[model samples]
Target: SGAVHFTRNNLSAYIRSNVRYLVALLVAGFDPSSGPELHYIDPFGSSVPIRYGGHGSGINFCTPIFEEFYKPTLDKRTAYNIIQKCVAEIQKRLVINLRNFDVFVIGREGITKLDPINQVSLRAQLMGNPPPRK
Candidate 1:
């Protein structure tokens, strides 16, 4: 797919030209001919297509969760649950306190934004407890 190749190449070139800047990205799309696609472009210009990937400070925490739960044919609800778990684990284990996350889905119909999930509330919900007092 030329579009996919072009996107990766363009990001690689951009990262190369802007060495001083941090430019990590997760590029996801739905190609009419190929279905869903996901790519991760790192700060060093290296890019690779992935079934599931995470970036930034919380990536290390999130990757294992994705690896354990990700399925190629997972349902939307199940996928959302995995993401919530990832955010929750990040909040719990990562030194940095990252709380809010914006979620979106790319499919045959195009991109759809889902409700933002808060790590604190999600963590409590997953634990079968109430949200922590502020």
Candidate 2:
């Protein structure tokens, strides 16, 4: 059976005991046949796969962005494109002092860190400007 495991933090444990509540969530697991998986855990601790997941102060404003551009069959490049576009909207419309973002890629080879997305790159893409020379 290809059941996805969705485990959440025992919230009752937090209310009864003084377990330190952390805002950030880490979702990781490996399926022998289906390969590896990662998720963004919500405050309630549900670990489910999502095409797009956001936490923090800008979620309300960010929903529209995801709604317009999200696709289920997105490859790596397309996924990053959506994320970049969302961040661009976030910076302009939302009040968060966001500057850049870090990207991490997961695959059969394991997780590999990628370059951070900065304001300059977003500006170029959003404005249709050419990429700067390496």
Question: How does residue 93 of candidate 1 score in lDDT?
Answer: 84
Every model's TM-score: 0.77, 0.68
Alpha-carbon lDDT of model 1 = 0.76
After superposition on all C-alphas, the RMSD of every candidate to the true structure, in Å, is: 4.7, 4.2
Clashes of 2: 0
Error of 1 at 79 (Å): 0.5
Q: Rate the local accuracy (lDDT) of all candidates.
A: 0.76, 0.64
Candidate 2, 85-117: lDDT as tens digits: 777777878766888787776666677665566
Task: For residue 101, give model 2's deviation from the true position in Å.
Answer: 0.9
Best by TM-score: 1
Q: Superposing every Cα of model 1 onto the true structure, what RMSD results?
A: 4.7
